[model samples]
Target: MASCAQKLLEIIYNRRSIRKYHRKPIPDDVLKAILEAGRQAPSARNLQPYCFIIVRDQELKKRLIFSEWNRFIEEAPVVIVGCGDSRAKWAVVDVAIALQNMVIAAEALGLGTCWIGHFIEEEVKKLLRIPEHIKVVAMITLGYPAEKPGPRPKKSLEELIRYETYE
Candidate 1:
Protein backbone atom coordinates (compact mmCIF):
# COMPACT_ATOMS: atom_id res chain seq x y z
CA MET A 1 0.00 0.00 0.00
CA ALA A 2 1.22 3.51 -0.78
CA SER A 3 1.88 5.87 2.10
CA CYS A 4 -0.30 8.96 2.52
CA ALA A 5 2.53 11.14 1.25
CA GLN A 6 2.93 8.97 -1.81
CA LYS A 7 -0.82 9.08 -2.44
CA LEU A 8 -0.81 12.85 -2.11
CA LEU A 9 2.06 13.16 -4.58
CA GLU A 10 0.13 11.08 -7.10
CA ILE A 11 -2.92 13.28 -6.64
CA ILE A 12 -0.82 16.41 -7.10
CA TYR A 13 0.81 15.10 -10.25
CA ASN A 14 -2.49 13.92 -11.70
CA ARG A 15 -4.43 17.12 -11.00
CA ARG A 16 -5.53 18.95 -14.15
CA SER A 17 -7.23 22.21 -14.96
CA ILE A 18 -10.52 20.74 -16.13
CA ARG A 19 -13.06 22.94 -17.85
CA LYS A 20 -15.56 20.62 -19.54
CA TYR A 21 -17.89 18.91 -17.11
CA HIS A 22 -20.84 16.53 -17.10
CA ARG A 23 -24.16 17.59 -15.58
CA LYS A 24 -23.96 15.87 -12.23
CA PRO A 25 -24.53 17.42 -8.86
CA ILE A 26 -21.95 16.68 -6.21
CA PRO A 27 -23.18 14.58 -3.30
CA ASP A 28 -23.84 16.62 -0.15
CA ASP A 29 -21.29 14.76 1.99
CA VAL A 30 -18.62 14.96 -0.68
CA LEU A 31 -19.24 18.66 -1.17
CA LYS A 32 -19.03 19.22 2.57
CA ALA A 33 -15.64 17.54 2.67
CA ILE A 34 -14.35 19.81 -0.05
CA LEU A 35 -15.68 22.92 1.72
CA GLU A 36 -14.22 21.78 5.03
CA ALA A 37 -10.82 21.44 3.42
CA GLY A 38 -10.86 25.14 2.62
CA ARG A 39 -12.14 26.14 6.05
CA GLN A 40 -9.40 24.18 7.78
CA ALA A 41 -6.60 25.87 5.82
CA PRO A 42 -4.23 27.98 7.90
CA SER A 43 -4.65 31.73 7.75
CA ALA A 44 -2.45 34.56 8.89
CA ARG A 45 -3.03 35.44 12.57
CA ASN A 46 -5.96 33.01 12.50
CA LEU A 47 -8.25 35.65 10.99
CA GLN A 48 -9.33 33.13 8.34
CA PRO A 49 -10.42 36.13 6.31
CA TYR A 50 -11.87 34.21 3.39
CA CYS A 51 -15.26 33.16 2.11
CA PHE A 52 -16.34 30.60 -0.49
CA ILE A 53 -19.47 31.42 -2.45
CA ILE A 54 -21.06 28.28 -3.85
CA VAL A 55 -22.94 29.24 -7.01
CA ARG A 56 -25.27 26.48 -8.12
CA ASP A 57 -27.98 28.50 -9.78
CA GLN A 58 -27.98 27.94 -13.50
CA GLU A 59 -29.25 31.42 -14.31
CA LEU A 60 -26.67 33.12 -12.10
CA LYS A 61 -23.85 31.00 -13.45
CA LYS A 62 -24.86 31.99 -16.95
CA ARG A 63 -24.58 35.65 -16.01
CA LEU A 64 -21.16 35.07 -14.43
CA ILE A 65 -19.86 33.61 -17.64
CA PHE A 66 -18.93 36.87 -19.34
CA SER A 67 -16.93 35.40 -22.25
CA GLU A 68 -16.03 32.29 -24.18
CA TRP A 69 -13.00 31.85 -21.93
CA ASN A 70 -15.29 31.34 -18.96
CA ARG A 71 -18.11 29.36 -20.56
CA PHE A 72 -17.27 26.46 -18.28
CA ILE A 73 -18.94 28.38 -15.49
CA GLU A 74 -22.27 27.71 -17.20
CA GLU A 75 -21.64 23.98 -17.59
CA ALA A 76 -20.16 23.27 -14.17
CA PRO A 77 -22.50 21.97 -11.49
CA VAL A 78 -20.91 24.27 -8.93
CA VAL A 79 -18.62 27.29 -8.88
CA ILE A 80 -16.88 28.33 -5.66
CA VAL A 81 -15.90 31.96 -5.55
CA GLY A 82 -13.06 32.57 -3.12
CA CYS A 83 -13.19 36.01 -1.57
CA GLY A 84 -10.81 37.69 0.85
CA ASP A 85 -11.18 40.63 3.19
CA SER A 86 -8.97 43.30 1.67
CA ARG A 87 -8.39 44.88 5.07
CA ALA A 88 -5.94 42.10 5.89
CA LYS A 89 -2.47 42.60 4.48
CA TRP A 90 -2.24 38.90 3.72
CA ALA A 91 -5.72 38.46 2.38
CA VAL A 92 -4.74 37.40 -1.13
CA VAL A 93 -2.24 34.85 0.10
CA ASP A 94 -4.66 33.46 2.67
CA VAL A 95 -7.52 33.10 0.24
CA ALA A 96 -5.27 31.46 -2.37
CA ILE A 97 -4.18 28.82 0.13
CA ALA A 98 -7.75 27.92 1.08
CA LEU A 99 -8.85 27.74 -2.53
CA GLN A 100 -5.99 25.37 -3.43
CA ASN A 101 -7.01 23.15 -0.53
CA MET A 102 -10.47 22.78 -2.00
CA VAL A 103 -9.04 22.04 -5.44
CA ILE A 104 -6.79 19.30 -4.10
CA ALA A 105 -9.64 17.82 -2.11
CA ALA A 106 -11.83 17.73 -5.19
CA GLU A 107 -9.14 16.02 -7.26
CA ALA A 108 -8.65 13.38 -4.56
CA LEU A 109 -12.37 12.65 -4.63
CA GLY A 110 -12.42 11.91 -8.40
CA LEU A 111 -13.89 15.31 -9.25
CA GLY A 112 -12.56 17.88 -11.72
CA THR A 113 -11.65 21.47 -10.79
CA CYS A 114 -10.57 24.58 -12.62
CA TRP A 115 -9.34 27.91 -11.31
CA ILE A 116 -10.88 30.79 -13.21
CA GLY A 117 -9.48 34.32 -12.96
CA HIS A 118 -10.15 36.12 -16.21
CA PHE A 119 -13.44 37.87 -15.53
CA ILE A 120 -14.75 41.36 -14.94
CA GLU A 121 -14.37 42.01 -11.21
CA GLU A 122 -17.10 44.61 -11.01
CA GLU A 123 -19.55 42.36 -12.85
CA VAL A 124 -18.74 39.38 -10.63
CA LYS A 125 -19.16 41.44 -7.48
CA LYS A 126 -22.58 42.52 -8.66
CA LEU A 127 -23.72 39.03 -9.58
CA LEU A 128 -22.42 37.44 -6.36
CA ARG A 129 -23.34 40.44 -4.20
CA ILE A 130 -19.76 40.57 -2.92
CA PRO A 131 -19.05 43.53 -0.68
CA GLU A 132 -16.61 46.28 -1.56
CA HIS A 133 -14.27 45.29 1.26
CA ILE A 134 -14.01 41.75 -0.02
CA LYS A 135 -11.82 41.11 -3.05
CA VAL A 136 -12.65 38.27 -5.37
CA VAL A 137 -9.43 36.28 -5.40
CA ALA A 138 -10.46 33.47 -7.74
CA MET A 139 -13.31 31.18 -8.67
CA ILE A 140 -13.24 27.42 -9.33
CA THR A 141 -15.62 25.31 -11.38
CA LEU A 142 -16.33 21.79 -10.15
CA GLY A 143 -18.11 18.73 -11.52
CA TYR A 144 -17.63 15.27 -13.00
CA PRO A 145 -15.17 15.73 -15.85
CA ALA A 146 -16.53 15.27 -19.36
CA GLU A 147 -13.01 15.23 -20.82
CA LYS A 148 -9.85 13.55 -19.54
CA PRO A 149 -6.69 15.46 -20.42
CA GLY A 150 -3.21 13.99 -20.57
CA PRO A 151 -0.59 15.33 -18.20
CA ARG A 152 0.88 18.61 -19.29
CA PRO A 153 4.63 19.02 -19.10
CA LYS A 154 6.22 20.72 -16.12
CA LYS A 155 9.63 22.19 -15.38
CA SER A 156 12.16 19.75 -13.97
CA LEU A 157 13.27 20.04 -10.33
CA GLU A 158 16.72 21.19 -11.40
CA GLU A 159 15.35 24.09 -13.40
CA LEU A 160 12.78 25.16 -10.79
CA ILE A 161 14.73 24.74 -7.56
CA ARG A 162 16.97 27.43 -6.12
CA TYR A 163 19.60 26.28 -3.66
CA GLU A 164 19.91 28.39 -0.50
CA THR A 165 19.49 31.70 -2.35
CA TYR A 166 18.94 33.15 -5.83
CA GLU A 167 21.66 32.09 -8.21
Candidate 2:
Protein backbone atom coordinates (compact mmCIF):
# COMPACT_ATOMS: atom_id res chain seq x y z
CA MET A 1 0.00 0.00 0.00
CA ALA A 2 1.16 3.52 -0.73
CA SER A 3 2.02 5.91 2.06
CA CYS A 4 -0.35 8.79 2.71
CA ALA A 5 2.10 11.28 1.21
CA GLN A 6 2.51 9.19 -1.90
CA LYS A 7 -1.24 8.82 -2.30
CA LEU A 8 -1.72 12.54 -1.91
CA LEU A 9 0.96 13.33 -4.48
CA GLU A 10 -0.63 10.95 -6.92
CA ILE A 11 -3.99 12.59 -6.45
CA ILE A 12 -2.61 16.11 -6.81
CA TYR A 13 -0.37 15.42 -9.77
CA ASN A 14 -3.11 13.61 -11.64
CA ARG A 15 -5.84 16.16 -11.06
CA ARG A 16 -7.02 18.22 -14.01
CA SER A 17 -9.77 20.73 -14.63
CA ILE A 18 -12.09 18.32 -16.34
CA ARG A 19 -14.67 20.12 -18.48
CA LYS A 20 -16.34 17.21 -20.25
CA TYR A 21 -18.02 14.43 -18.34
CA HIS A 22 -19.65 11.05 -18.80
CA ARG A 23 -23.39 10.73 -18.43
CA LYS A 24 -23.15 8.57 -15.29
CA PRO A 25 -23.99 10.10 -11.94
CA ILE A 26 -21.77 9.96 -8.87
CA PRO A 27 -22.71 7.46 -6.17
CA ASP A 28 -24.22 8.88 -3.00
CA ASP A 29 -21.58 7.38 -0.73
CA VAL A 30 -18.76 8.78 -2.84
CA LEU A 31 -20.36 12.20 -3.00
CA LYS A 32 -20.74 12.23 0.78
CA ALA A 33 -17.06 11.42 1.25
CA ILE A 34 -16.09 14.30 -1.02
CA LEU A 35 -18.32 16.72 0.89
CA GLU A 36 -16.92 15.43 4.18
CA ALA A 37 -13.41 16.23 2.98
CA GLY A 38 -14.50 19.82 2.35
CA ARG A 39 -16.16 19.97 5.76
CA GLN A 40 -12.87 19.04 7.38
CA ALA A 41 -10.87 21.86 5.78
CA PRO A 42 -9.16 24.30 8.11
CA SER A 43 -10.57 27.80 8.53
CA ALA A 44 -9.52 31.02 10.23
CA ARG A 45 -10.71 30.98 13.87
CA ASN A 46 -12.18 27.60 13.06
CA LEU A 47 -15.31 29.46 12.05
CA GLN A 48 -15.82 27.26 8.97
CA PRO A 49 -18.04 29.98 7.60
CA TYR A 50 -18.67 28.17 4.35
CA CYS A 51 -21.72 26.49 2.89
CA PHE A 52 -22.10 24.35 -0.22
CA ILE A 53 -25.16 24.08 -2.40
CA ILE A 54 -25.47 20.79 -4.23
CA VAL A 55 -27.30 21.15 -7.56
CA ARG A 56 -28.57 17.97 -9.19
CA ASP A 57 -31.81 19.22 -10.67
CA GLN A 58 -31.41 19.27 -14.42
CA GLU A 59 -33.60 22.31 -14.90
CA LEU A 60 -31.80 24.26 -12.24
CA LYS A 61 -28.47 23.37 -13.79
CA LYS A 62 -29.66 24.66 -17.13
CA ARG A 63 -30.73 27.92 -15.57
CA LEU A 64 -27.28 28.35 -13.97
CA ILE A 65 -25.69 29.12 -17.31
CA PHE A 66 -24.30 32.63 -17.20
CA SER A 67 -21.82 32.27 -20.07
CA GLU A 68 -21.35 30.26 -23.21
CA TRP A 69 -18.07 28.77 -21.97
CA ASN A 70 -19.76 27.51 -18.81
CA ARG A 71 -22.42 25.53 -20.60
CA PHE A 72 -20.49 22.41 -19.73
CA ILE A 73 -21.58 22.93 -16.13
CA GLU A 74 -25.10 21.88 -16.98
CA GLU A 75 -23.77 18.66 -18.53
CA ALA A 76 -21.99 17.51 -15.40
CA PRO A 77 -23.71 15.11 -13.02
CA VAL A 78 -23.45 17.62 -10.18
CA VAL A 79 -22.61 21.24 -9.50
CA ILE A 80 -21.57 22.51 -6.07
CA VAL A 81 -21.83 26.19 -5.21
CA GLY A 82 -19.36 27.27 -2.56
CA CYS A 83 -20.55 30.26 -0.60
CA GLY A 84 -19.19 32.12 2.41
CA ASP A 85 -20.41 34.59 4.96
CA SER A 86 -19.83 38.19 3.91
CA ARG A 87 -18.99 39.23 7.47
CA ALA A 88 -16.04 36.86 7.82
CA LYS A 89 -12.69 38.38 6.96
CA TRP A 90 -11.34 35.06 5.73
CA ALA A 91 -14.55 33.77 4.24
CA VAL A 92 -13.33 33.78 0.63
CA VAL A 93 -10.07 32.03 1.47
CA ASP A 94 -11.83 29.59 3.75
CA VAL A 95 -14.39 28.66 1.16
CA ALA A 96 -11.71 28.30 -1.52
CA ILE A 97 -9.69 25.95 0.68
CA ALA A 98 -12.76 23.87 1.44
CA LEU A 99 -13.66 23.64 -2.22
CA GLN A 100 -10.11 22.64 -3.13
CA ASN A 101 -10.28 19.90 -0.52
CA MET A 102 -13.43 18.62 -2.19
CA VAL A 103 -11.68 18.80 -5.57
CA ILE A 104 -8.77 16.67 -4.39
CA ALA A 105 -11.09 14.23 -2.66
CA ALA A 106 -13.19 13.88 -5.79
CA GLU A 107 -10.09 13.22 -7.88
CA ALA A 108 -8.96 10.55 -5.45
CA LEU A 109 -12.34 8.91 -5.79
CA GLY A 110 -12.01 8.55 -9.59
CA LEU A 111 -14.13 11.59 -10.20
CA GLY A 112 -13.45 14.78 -12.14
CA THR A 113 -14.03 18.37 -11.03
CA CYS A 114 -13.81 21.76 -12.70
CA TRP A 115 -13.70 25.01 -10.81
CA ILE A 116 -16.28 27.47 -12.12
CA GLY A 117 -15.13 30.98 -11.38
CA HIS A 118 -17.18 33.00 -13.83
CA PHE A 119 -20.80 33.69 -12.93
CA ILE A 120 -23.15 36.52 -12.18
CA GLU A 121 -23.45 36.61 -8.42
CA GLU A 122 -26.82 38.27 -8.42
CA GLU A 123 -28.29 35.79 -10.87
CA VAL A 124 -26.94 32.85 -8.93
CA LYS A 125 -28.24 34.22 -5.67
CA LYS A 126 -31.62 34.92 -7.18
CA LEU A 127 -31.80 31.44 -8.71
CA LEU A 128 -30.72 29.65 -5.54
CA ARG A 129 -32.40 32.06 -3.14
CA ILE A 130 -29.08 32.67 -1.37
CA PRO A 131 -29.16 35.17 1.45
CA GLU A 132 -27.83 38.70 1.11
CA HIS A 133 -25.40 38.13 3.95
CA ILE A 134 -23.65 35.41 2.02
CA LYS A 135 -21.37 35.70 -1.01
CA VAL A 136 -20.90 33.15 -3.74
CA VAL A 137 -17.24 32.29 -3.60
CA ALA A 138 -17.16 29.81 -6.44
CA MET A 139 -18.72 26.77 -8.05
CA ILE A 140 -17.47 23.34 -9.10
CA THR A 141 -18.76 20.84 -11.62
CA LEU A 142 -18.29 17.16 -10.71
CA GLY A 143 -18.73 13.93 -12.61
CA TYR A 144 -17.07 10.97 -14.32
CA PRO A 145 -14.60 12.32 -16.88
CA ALA A 146 -15.36 11.90 -20.54
CA GLU A 147 -11.87 12.91 -21.64
CA LYS A 148 -8.40 12.14 -20.34
CA PRO A 149 -6.60 15.45 -20.24
CA GLY A 150 -2.82 15.57 -20.07
CA PRO A 151 -1.13 17.61 -17.40
CA ARG A 152 -1.09 21.32 -18.16
CA PRO A 153 2.10 23.33 -17.84
CA LYS A 154 3.17 24.67 -14.47
CA LYS A 155 6.01 26.88 -13.25
CA SER A 156 8.96 25.11 -11.64
CA LEU A 157 9.26 25.13 -7.86
CA GLU A 158 12.24 27.46 -8.11
CA GLU A 159 10.20 29.91 -10.16
CA LEU A 160 7.21 29.89 -7.82
CA ILE A 161 8.95 29.77 -4.42
CA ARG A 162 10.85 32.48 -2.57
CA TYR A 163 13.32 31.71 0.21
CA GLU A 164 12.66 34.61 2.56
CA THR A 165 11.68 38.00 1.17
CA TYR A 166 11.44 39.76 -2.16
CA GLU A 167 14.89 40.73 -3.36
Candidate 3:
Protein backbone atom coordinates (compact mmCIF):
# COMPACT_ATOMS: atom_id res chain seq x y z
CA MET A 1 0.00 0.00 0.00
CA ALA A 2 1.13 3.55 -0.62
CA SER A 3 2.06 5.80 2.28
CA CYS A 4 -0.29 8.57 3.32
CA ALA A 5 1.96 11.24 1.79
CA GLN A 6 2.12 9.34 -1.49
CA LYS A 7 -1.66 8.93 -1.56
CA LEU A 8 -2.08 12.64 -0.93
CA LEU A 9 0.30 13.53 -3.72
CA GLU A 10 -1.57 11.25 -6.10
CA ILE A 11 -4.86 12.86 -5.20
CA ILE A 12 -3.43 16.33 -5.77
CA TYR A 13 -1.85 15.40 -9.07
CA ASN A 14 -4.99 13.72 -10.46
CA ARG A 15 -7.41 16.47 -9.49
CA ARG A 16 -8.90 18.41 -12.38
CA SER A 17 -11.52 21.07 -12.96
CA ILE A 18 -14.35 18.65 -13.64
CA ARG A 19 -17.16 20.23 -15.61
CA LYS A 20 -19.29 17.17 -16.27
CA TYR A 21 -20.89 15.33 -13.37
CA HIS A 22 -23.10 12.35 -12.62
CA ARG A 23 -26.70 13.09 -11.71
CA LYS A 24 -26.33 11.53 -8.31
CA PRO A 25 -26.47 13.32 -4.96
CA ILE A 26 -23.66 13.34 -2.43
CA PRO A 27 -24.32 11.61 0.88
CA ASP A 28 -24.83 13.88 3.88
CA ASP A 29 -21.86 12.39 5.72
CA VAL A 30 -19.60 12.80 2.71
CA LEU A 31 -20.68 16.39 2.29
CA LYS A 32 -20.04 17.04 5.97
CA ALA A 33 -16.54 15.61 5.71
CA ILE A 34 -15.77 17.87 2.75
CA LEU A 35 -17.04 20.95 4.58
CA GLU A 36 -15.14 19.94 7.69
CA ALA A 37 -11.95 19.87 5.70
CA GLY A 38 -12.53 23.48 4.70
CA ARG A 39 -13.37 24.44 8.27
CA GLN A 40 -10.07 23.02 9.50
CA ALA A 41 -7.90 25.09 7.16
CA PRO A 42 -5.49 27.55 8.77
CA SER A 43 -6.22 31.25 8.74
CA ALA A 44 -4.27 34.43 9.35
CA ARG A 45 -4.01 34.89 13.14
CA ASN A 46 -6.57 32.08 13.43
CA LEU A 47 -9.32 34.61 12.79
CA GLN A 48 -10.78 32.31 10.04
CA PRO A 49 -13.07 35.03 8.79
CA TYR A 50 -14.80 32.87 6.22
CA CYS A 51 -18.23 31.39 5.62
CA PHE A 52 -19.60 28.97 3.04
CA ILE A 53 -23.02 29.03 1.45
CA ILE A 54 -24.01 25.54 0.35
CA VAL A 55 -26.39 25.79 -2.57
CA ARG A 56 -28.40 22.62 -3.26
CA ASP A 57 -31.68 23.95 -4.44
CA GLN A 58 -32.12 23.49 -8.17
CA GLU A 59 -33.82 26.83 -8.66
CA LEU A 60 -31.13 28.65 -6.75
CA LYS A 61 -28.46 26.88 -8.76
CA LYS A 62 -30.11 27.97 -12.00
CA ARG A 63 -30.41 31.49 -10.69
CA LEU A 64 -26.68 31.60 -9.98
CA ILE A 65 -25.85 31.31 -13.66
CA PHE A 66 -23.98 34.42 -14.78
CA SER A 67 -22.04 33.33 -17.84
CA GLU A 68 -22.00 30.76 -20.64
CA TRP A 69 -18.70 29.31 -19.50
CA ASN A 70 -20.10 28.40 -16.09
CA ARG A 71 -23.37 26.89 -17.25
CA PHE A 72 -22.21 23.70 -15.57
CA ILE A 73 -22.80 25.39 -12.22
CA GLU A 74 -26.41 24.30 -12.40
CA GLU A 75 -25.46 20.69 -13.09
CA ALA A 76 -23.32 20.01 -10.05
CA PRO A 77 -25.06 18.52 -7.04
CA VAL A 78 -23.63 21.19 -4.75
CA VAL A 79 -22.19 24.66 -5.14
CA ILE A 80 -20.23 26.15 -2.28
CA VAL A 81 -20.02 29.91 -2.22
CA GLY A 82 -16.96 31.05 -0.31
CA CYS A 83 -17.36 34.37 1.46
CA GLY A 84 -15.10 36.47 3.64
CA ASP A 85 -15.60 39.33 6.04
CA SER A 86 -14.67 42.69 4.58
CA ARG A 87 -13.06 43.89 7.79
CA ALA A 88 -10.64 40.97 8.00
CA LYS A 89 -7.15 41.86 6.77
CA TRP A 90 -6.60 38.52 5.01
CA ALA A 91 -10.13 37.43 4.35
CA VAL A 92 -9.64 36.75 0.68
CA VAL A 93 -6.53 34.66 1.16
CA ASP A 94 -7.99 32.79 4.11
CA VAL A 95 -11.18 31.95 2.25
CA ALA A 96 -9.24 30.80 -0.80
CA ILE A 97 -7.14 28.41 1.29
CA ALA A 98 -10.22 27.01 2.96
CA LEU A 99 -11.95 26.39 -0.33
CA GLN A 100 -8.86 24.68 -1.72
CA ASN A 101 -8.88 22.38 1.29
CA MET A 102 -12.42 21.39 0.47
CA VAL A 103 -11.42 20.74 -3.12
CA ILE A 104 -8.62 18.39 -2.05
CA ALA A 105 -10.85 16.54 0.36
CA ALA A 106 -13.52 16.09 -2.27
CA GLU A 107 -11.01 14.70 -4.74
CA ALA A 108 -9.75 12.26 -2.14
CA LEU A 109 -13.28 10.96 -1.72
CA GLY A 110 -13.76 10.21 -5.45
CA LEU A 111 -15.56 13.48 -6.06
CA GLY A 112 -14.76 16.29 -8.47
CA THR A 113 -14.76 20.06 -8.09
CA CYS A 114 -14.56 23.09 -10.38
CA TRP A 115 -13.73 26.55 -9.21
CA ILE A 116 -16.13 29.13 -10.61
CA GLY A 117 -14.67 32.62 -10.55
CA HIS A 118 -16.96 34.41 -12.95
CA PHE A 119 -20.11 35.81 -11.38
CA ILE A 120 -21.81 39.11 -10.71
CA GLU A 121 -21.20 39.99 -7.06
CA GLU A 122 -24.29 42.05 -6.62
CA GLU A 123 -26.51 39.43 -8.24
CA VAL A 124 -25.09 36.68 -6.06
CA LYS A 125 -25.55 38.78 -2.95
CA LYS A 126 -29.10 39.55 -3.93
CA LEU A 127 -29.92 35.95 -4.78
CA LEU A 128 -28.27 34.47 -1.70
CA ARG A 129 -29.00 37.35 0.66
CA ILE A 130 -25.33 37.70 1.60
CA PRO A 131 -24.63 40.41 4.14
CA GLU A 132 -23.25 43.76 2.99
CA HIS A 133 -20.16 43.33 5.15
CA ILE A 134 -19.24 40.05 3.56
CA LYS A 135 -17.58 39.60 0.15
CA VAL A 136 -17.77 36.58 -2.11
CA VAL A 137 -14.29 35.21 -2.66
CA ALA A 138 -15.17 32.39 -5.08
CA MET A 139 -17.53 29.52 -5.81
CA ILE A 140 -16.87 25.80 -6.27
CA THR A 141 -19.11 23.15 -7.83
CA LEU A 142 -18.86 19.65 -6.41
CA GLY A 143 -20.18 16.26 -7.51
CA TYR A 144 -19.32 12.82 -8.88
CA PRO A 145 -17.43 13.31 -12.11
CA ALA A 146 -18.93 11.83 -15.25
CA GLU A 147 -15.72 12.15 -17.20
CA LYS A 148 -12.04 11.54 -16.49
CA PRO A 149 -10.09 14.28 -18.17
CA GLY A 150 -6.36 13.98 -18.75
CA PRO A 151 -3.96 16.53 -17.33
CA ARG A 152 -3.72 19.80 -19.21
CA PRO A 153 -0.48 21.40 -20.35
CA LYS A 154 1.80 22.72 -17.63
CA LYS A 155 5.15 24.50 -17.30
CA SER A 156 8.11 22.29 -16.41
CA LEU A 157 10.18 22.82 -13.21
CA GLU A 158 13.06 24.21 -15.22
CA GLU A 159 10.87 26.89 -16.77
CA LEU A 160 8.83 27.75 -13.69
CA ILE A 161 11.45 27.49 -10.93
CA ARG A 162 14.56 29.56 -10.24
CA TYR A 163 17.49 28.56 -8.04
CA GLU A 164 17.72 30.80 -4.94
CA THR A 165 17.09 34.04 -6.83
CA TYR A 166 16.05 35.36 -10.25
CA GLU A 167 19.31 35.49 -12.16
lDDT of 1 by residue, 1-167 (tens): 66998999999999999989999899999999999999999999999998899999999989888778888888999999999999999999999999999999999999999998887889999988999999999889999999999988999999999999986
Ranking, TM-score, top scorer first: 2, 3, 1
Q: What residue runs in model 2 are displaced by over 4 Å at the alpha carbon?
A: none
User: Which residue ranges in model 3 land beyond 4 Å of their true spot?
Assistant: none
How would you encode candidate 3's per-residue C-alpha lDDT over 1-167 as one tens digit per residue?
A: 66998999999999999999997999999999999999999999999998999999999999888989888988899999999998999999999999999999999999999998999999999999999999999999999999899998999999999999999
Better of 2 and 3 by lDDT: 3
How does model 3 score by TM-score?
0.96
Better-scoring candidate (lDDT), 1 or 2: 2
Ranking by lDDT: 3, 2, 1
The estimated TM-scores of all candidates read: 0.96, 0.96, 0.96
Question: Global lDDT of each model?
Answer: 0.92, 0.95, 0.96
The residue pairs found clashing in candidate 3 are none
